[model samples]
Target: MSGFASWIGGALGWTLGGPIGAAIGFAIGAAVDKATSKGLLLEPPKRGSQQRRKRVDPVYEKRRRRKTVREKQAQTKSGDFEVSLLVLSAIVMKVDGEVSESEKDFVRNYFTKMYGKQRANHAFKLFNGLLKKEDISTRQICQQIQMYMDHSSRLQLLHYLFGVTKADGHVDESEVDLIEKIAGYLYINDRDFQSIKAMFYNPVDSAYKILEIDKSATNNEIKKAYRKMAKKFHPDKLEHLGEEHMKGANEKFQKVQKAYEQLQKERGF
Candidate 1:
C-alpha cells in the first residue's frame, strides 16, 4: 500500500472516539495528505513483469517500504500534534478574556522555528481560523491528547504550554487555573502538574514542587523523586519527538537539575 494509505489506516486504528477527536483527526489527516502527496508518499507502479521484479531483493524492498511507512506515520503524528497544540494554545491564551498579538506571535515564531516558513504559515493560518471559533473545550482536547501521548510526552507538552504563558513575563492566574484543569482532564497526577507548574511560576515551595514532593517528605524521598524526574525529562528520552522537542525537553531537564542543586544547597546535602 501507499504511504498515505498506511498513515490513514494507522490513524483510524487509534482510539480517537469522540467528536473532538474525529474533528481533529480529519483536519490533521487532510493537512498531512496535502503536504505529503507531492513527495515521498506517492508510490509509482511496478513497471515490469513479475519475473523481472523477482530479480530484485525481496527483503530489501520489504524493509525499505516498511521504513517509508514508519516515516510517513511519524510525520502524520507530528502534524496532528502541532495542530492540537495550536487549538489548545488558543484556548489558553484567551483564558484571561483576550488573546494578545504578542501571544499569537510567540506561537507563530515557535512554528516557524520548528517547521519551515511554508508549513509555519499554513499552520498559523489554520490556527488563526480555528481561533475564531468559540466552541473549543479544554476537557475534550485534553482527553484526546491523553489517549495517544505517553505521560512523559504530556509533561513535555505542559511544559511548552507554560512557556507560552510566560512569554509575557508573568502567567495570569486564569491561565494557571485552565492549565490545572487541562492537567486533570489529561489524567496527569497532581504531583507532576505542580512539578511542571513550579518550573514557570514563582512560588515559595519552588524546590518541593520541582521535586514533586511535599515539604514533609524525607530527604531520601526527595532525592529519589529528583532522580526519577531527571530520567523522565532527559533529552535523550524525547529524541523520537524531533530536534525542536528535544531542545525544549533539555531546557526543562536543566530546570530540574537546578532545582535539585538549590535543595542541596539549602539542606547541605
Candidate 2:
C-alpha cells in the first residue's frame, strides 16, 4: 500500500481491499487529511455499559455515497473493450502453434490507436506475459466475458477475433477452431458464430450473415433483424470506450447498415 492507502485505511476504519476501497480513496483525494482529522477528533467511546458506537461523520458519509457514484462512472470509462480485445487477441495469435510477427504488428498498431504508444507497449508486454504462462485457460477468460458482457458485445468480440486472425490476409485452421471453441464457451449460438464467421472468411452471402437473417425470412423479419443489429453495433454504444473504439464500432455499424440497404434494394422492399 502507498502512504495514502495506509493513511486511508487507518483513518476511515475501512479495510482498503477491493473496488470500493479504491473508489473511496480516489474520492477522498486531497481531502484525506481533513477526513483523517475528523476521525481523530471523534470522542473516544466510554468504557463498560456506557460504551457506545462511534458516531459516523455526515460529511464522510456524503462523500462515501458520492464515491460510489463516481466508482460506477469510472468503471464505465475504464477500457473493458480494449482489455478484453487484447486477451482474446493473444489467444488468436498463439492458437496456431506460434505467434506470427504480422499478428503482433497488427495488435501493436491496434493498441497504439486505442491507447497511446506507451500504453500500447505495456499492453503488448502483458500479452507476452499471458503467452508465457504454461496453462492459459481460454474457457475461464471466455466465462468471465460471458458473465460481464452483453450478447451483442460478445458477438462483437467474436467479430474482432476474426479480424485479428485475418489480419495477415489468411485465417489459420487452428485459429478458426480456437475461435469456435471460444464462441462455445461464450454460449454463442452456432448460427451466430457462422454468421459472424461468414463476414470475414466467406463473403458469398455476407449481407444475410451481417443482418443475421435468412433468405426464407419474411421482409418484416429482415427489418427486425436489421434494427436489432443496428442497435447492437451502434457507435453510440461504444462511446464510453473512447473515440477510437467508437470509430471501429461505427465501421461495424456501417457494415450492418450496408447489408440492410443491399437486401432492400435487391428485394425491392
Candidate 3:
C-alpha cells in the first residue's frame, strides 16, 4: 500500500483498537504482502517513520493573509473616524466659551455607546493628544470633519454637537459661533442649519405659531414656503446688504428652515 493509505488505515485501526493492536495489524499486513511478493517476512513500521506532507494549499493561505490585512485596514479606519469625531465634538463643546459637566457627560456617554468602554477610553486619549496641540485651528478641525463624514452623517454630527452645547440647558454665543464655523465647513447653508435647530430646539406650540402654518399643511405648500423663505434669506442674495446685515439674515434664514422642518415632521409630511 502507499504510504498515505497505510497511514490512514493505521490511524483508523489505532482509533478503533489500541496502540498494540494497531502495531500487530500493521505487522501482519506487511508480512503477508512481503511473503506473497518476495517470499520474505516484514516487520511492523515504526511509529515515527512517516513524515507529514507540508500544506500546499497556496490559495487558502493567500486568502487567510488577505483577510488579516483587511481586518487591519478596517481597524485603522475605525480608529481614524473615532479620533476625528472626538476632537470635533470637543471643539464644539468648548465653543460656547465653556465646557460644563453636563457637556462632558454627554461626550463621555456618546463615546461609550459608540465604541464601548475600552475603545472609548482610547478615543479619549487621542482627544487629549489633539487638544494639547496649540496650533490646531477650530476651522481646520471642522473642515476635516466635513471631508470625512457624509452629508447626512455630518448633519447628525452637527445635531449631536448642538446637543452637547445645549446640555447645560443654555446655548452660549461661543457655541453658536463654533456651530456656524462647522456649518460653513460642511457647506450647510445658514438656512439649513437653522432648520435643523428649530426641529430640535423649538417648542412645539411656538414653532407652529411662528411658521403661521397649520399642522396639516399639504406637502406642496410646505415645499412652497421653504423655497420662498430660502430665496428671501439666501446669503448670496443678501450680500449687497453688507456683512453685518447678511450675517443676521443668514441666522434668521436658518431659523426659518428649522421651523419649517419641525412643522413638517409634526404633520408627517
Best by lDDT: 1
Winner by lDDT between candidate 3 and candidate 1: 1
Best by TM-score: 1
Task: Please provide, for model 2 over 150-268, each residue's C-alpha lDDT reduced to its tens digit, 9 standing for 90 to 100.
Answer: 56556777888888898887778999999999999989988778777877765778889888877888889999999998887787775655686665677688888888898899989
Off by over 4 Å in 2: 1-77
Candidate 1 has an lDDT of: 0.71
What CA RMSD would you report for each candidate? 9.8, 10.8, 25.5
lDDT of 3 by residue, 1-269 (tens): 34423332322211222322222234334433533344222334568758886787999989987676445333323333344456567667655555677776776777676556754554454444444444446665555445434444454456666767777787787777778777888777765576556545665564543344455667787777777756655666534323423443455567667767876786677
TM-score of 3: 0.48
Looking at candidate 3, what is the lDDT of residue 53? 61
Worst 10 residues of 3 by lDDT: 11-20
Model 2: ten consecutive residues of lowest lDDT = 13-22
What's the lDDT of the predicted structure labeled candidate 2? 0.68
What TM-score does candidate 1 get on C-alpha atoms? 0.73
Q: Tell me the whole-model lDDT of each prediction, alpha carbons only.
A: 0.71, 0.68, 0.54
Q: Which ten residues in a row have the lowest lDDT in candidate 1?
A: 8-17
Off by over 4 Å in 3: 1-80, 203-219, 223-269
Candidate 1 clashing pairs, residues 3+ apart or interchain: none
Clashing pairs in 3: 95-174, 96-175, 194-254, 195-257, 195-258
